[model samples]
Target: MNQKQLVVRHRLRELMVAHDIPSVQELSRRTGIYYATLLNFYHNKFNTFNNRTIATLCEFFDCRIDELIYLDKKELCGA
Candidate 1:
């Protein structure tokens, strides 16, 4: 069987460093996204995310969704 996993690249940290964002709180303030949500993204804990959030982040960062998340495929071998 084959399975696919959605892997988040989490480029916000790098973008923050490049843009001197300082902290997630600052990012939240700049993007109007909740600090807790940004914190979860920073920590790679993305159990709950939606199009609105993604759109907001993309608009704030001037980036596309592909820059934020991607999928990875894995194959399982059965005996």
Candidate 2:
């Protein structure tokens, strides 16, 4: 995955942790995402995820796409 993608994934997980969510199960309950699909996101096992998953994440996290996921070129240089 690209740096932006990796950063987004890491940030999302950090947000979840900050909220004291101990498991993906809690996120699934809040976001209505299946455990298996959530695993995909948690592990960054795929290069791309479905639009539905993205939308759900945005809604449940109370964040815009740009907040939860951004295409930050600066991340590439470790800036």
Candidate 3:
């Protein structure tokens, strides 16, 4: 049987651009989230997602959960 893995990707940068947010610092100030935490999400360097963070982003951006994060399936090396 073939194996697959689902990876979650963040759209923070795109959302920021669409919303006319200038910088991560500005976003952090606006959203009341830490710069480092938002930066991690912006660069997709996170392994786990926090419910509060996701809710905060969705509320701040007026976007859906799907819009904030999406899934990509990749084939495993061995099936």
TM-scores for the candidates: 0.75, 0.67, 0.85
Encode model 3's per-residue lDDT on 1-79: one tens digit a residue: 7788998977888999999999999999998999999888888789888899999999999999999899999788767
Off by over 4 Å in 1: 1-6, 72-79
The numbered model that scores best in TM-score is 3
Model 2 C-alpha lDDT per residue in residues 1-79, reported as the tens digit of each score: 3354243343578768767778898899888899888887788676776899888888877778776666533345453
Clashing pairs in 1: none
lDDT of 3 at 48: 88
What CA root-mean-square deviation does each model show from the true structure? 2.9, 5.2, 1.8
Ranking by TM-score: 3, 1, 2
Candidate that beats the other on TM-score, 2 or 3, i.e. the better one: 3
Q: Candidate 2 at 61: error in angstroms? A: 0.8
lDDT of 2: 0.73
Superposed by TM-score, candidate 2 places the C-alpha of residue 73 at a distance from the truth, in angstroms, of: 6.0
Q: lDDT for each of the candidates?
A: 0.79, 0.73, 0.91
Error of 3 at 32 (Å): 0.6
